[model samples]
Target chain A: MVTVLFFAAAKEAAGMELLRLEVSQSLSLLQLQQRVLQLVPALQPLQSLLLWAVNNQYAVPAQVIESGDTVACFPPVSGG
Target chain B: MIQLTDQPLDYAAITESVRDPAAGAVVLFLGTVREFTAGQQTEQLEYEAYREMALASLQQLVQEAASMYPLVKVAVVHRLGVLQLTDVAVAIAVSTPHRAQAFAAGQWLIDTLKQRVPIWKREHYVDGRVQWQHPSQEAAVAPVVGEAS
Candidate 1:
């Protein structure tokens, strides 16, 4: 299972802070993102702008994700 | 010192922590909540962070600033949770052997922290509206639904 976390505006849109998905094999970040959009279509508009992180580091779309990895998605940060 | 705190930020303590005998200049920068933005009256701000990542990012930025400039010490503290207008939200202090380096490092620290840290702010307007502020290159998403005014 992969744990997907959301924050800030993304969390507000998705209506929850996190969710878990059962994955049988590894998938690219893009694939995971598509899966999330499938589940939460409200996030579709933010697909291009969403920032992804894998295990706490900024992630690229092509990054690989295994079952136990934790992925987070959020809008750009605006804090000082 | 790099920290994410729920308590009020103490700029004096942060400034004192970065004091060094070898340093001749110290610069402290505070980010406070303002009352208005683009003609809207803001009542308060709520801040949140991916705590672990935010702290790691801050520490990395401090190290980077120290290596990029001639500095003696650097400290950063960011507050989380709701804050009224004019409340201090973040504080940064840098000490260097000269005023130029101190000022430069302090500015860079705050600017870079805003861009790189995984912290966020939600503004509560006086007119029963709330919005999450977005950084440059991203649009503000939909308003928070199902939340009480």
Candidate 2:
């Protein structure tokens, strides 16, 4: 299972802060993102702008995800 | 030092933390909540972050700045949660052997933090409406100035 965390506007739009995905095999970050968007269509609009982090570091769509890894998604930051 | 806190920021303490004997210049930058944005009157602002990633990103930025510049000390503190107008949102201090490096490091730190950190801010207007301020979403919303409360 891979855990996906959401924050700020993403959390509000997702209606939950975290989701545990049951992955039968290894999946690429792009596939993971697609799965997440399927489950939470509210995130559709943010698909292109969402920033992904894998295991606490910035991740690209091609990054692979294994079971037990944590993924976090959020919109572009505006903090100073 | 890099931190994300829910409590109010102490600028004096932040400034003191970066004091170094080898450094001849120290630059402190504070980001405060403003009463207006694009002519809109803001009541309060709420900040949120993916804490774990935010901290890691902040530490990385400090290290990168140190390596790129001749900085002696660096510290950054960002406040989370609801904040009133004029409240300090973020504070950064950088000390270097020269004023030029210190100023450059300080500016780079704050600018990079705003772009890379996982923190987000929500603007609360007096009209009972709230808007999330993010780089990708800002252009879609029209500016609506609000009356002061």
In terms of TM-score, the best-performing candidate is 2
Residues A1-80 of candidate 2: C-alpha lDDT, one tens digit per residue: 99999998889999999999999999999999999999999999877667788887877678899999999988888887
Model 2 chain B lDDT-worst window of ten: B140-149
Worst 10 residues of 1 chain B by lDDT: B140-149
Model 2 lDDT tens row, B1-149: 79999999999999999999999999999999999788999999999989997897788888888779998999999999999999999999999999999999999888778777789999999888998898656543211112111
Model 2 misses residue B111 by how many Å?
0.7
Candidate 1 docks at the CAPRI level of acceptable
Worst 10 residues of 2 chain A by lDDT: A45-54
Error of 1 at B78 (Å): 0.5
How does model 2 score on DockQ? 0.44
How many steric clashes does model 2 contain? 0
Q: Residue B27 lDDT in model 2? A: 97
